[model samples]
Target: MSHHSKAKQLLQQRDELDEKVKELLLVLETNNSTMDSPLVDAEGYPLNTIDVYAVRHARHDLICLRNDRAQWTEKIVEEMEQDEEKMGESAPIEEKPVHRTSNEPFVKVSSVVELSPADVGGFRKEDLIIQYGNLHHGNFKNMQQVAEITKEYENKTIRVTVIRDHRPVRLEISPKKWSGPGLLGCNIVPIAGANV
Candidate 1:
């Protein structure tokens, strides 16, 4: 996500919390007797201070929750991202490419020269179909179509149209392939405008 978009979301969340804080403050500051909702103490008389402190506690909790959200949503995303980059460089052993599950949209091909090594890892012929990437068919259609396009693209750039949950959408996935295996050894799903 872009910095501007994140800033906008944080600003909106902060504004909403501020409005809630103001509303709670107004309710606590009220001196009218009729607004009391039968709240009573040991003596059976209405407890005004009791209600005041309750609202105060709620306001305090809201403030704490907002602070926690700011710490995680604003300050933590960048730090975690940096950690990921550092980890990527300093790993102890040679890394192997990990392919997504059949349930996801990602695709991969084995290295032709190192086909045995790639095959020994995790990829399999049955694991090659492109589907919604960790998403269901109904929540959104466009991304599922992306999966279809990714599969069909194989090692060449291509466009595709797919019916996700009965809605049609178009997507284009970049051309990426394993030259060693010479076409990834998987039968790619055919989509629109494909040369078959």
Candidate 2:
């Protein structure tokens, strides 16, 4: 099969895996449980309120599906890289001016509470926040600005851009009431010496 065809097939598989992960997450939510939530009581007995069996199964499935997705993603990337290499061999490359900006990442995500808005929005720990709604490295002043923005866009989706593993990932997060204390339920700290 061609590289393009392989990439397309991998992408479809990844999408299907994502859907399965979402379904498992819903099952966990229905049981009022997070991945780390204890299924047993203090005395080592299964909790009476939650369906421990279902939750355990959902969590296990989620883990497996996530691993599958990661492998699919790597395969897709490899296929795309091969395609790029083939194209580069046939065409002359044109150099474009690189625009360098001093706008560095201002805030770093320290933690994300499971099942919270941030978690649901795909926020991960150690993610460097380059943009949060209208706040960016150039205009961001402090954590207070982030708080204000979150309050202003309550229940509304806000575009968030973070650098994870040296790649930019964009996410839409809405601050809303949940089982967590804060809207985001994520801790962010300003980067030292970073322009805010």
Candidate achieving the largest lDDT: 2
Candidate 2 residue-wise lDDT, 57-167, digit = tens: 999998888667656754664565466566654322442211213225889999999999999999999998877877876777778999998999899877776767644
Q: Residue by residue across 84-135, what tens digits does model 1's lDDT show?
A: 4455644335333222221223332222233532233323432332332223
Alpha carbon lDDT of each predicted model? 0.40, 0.78
- Report how far off residue 91 is in candidate 2 (Å): 36
Note the clash tally of each candidate: 2, 1
Give lDDT: candidate 2, residue 48.
91
Off by over 4 Å in 2: 1-103, 194-196
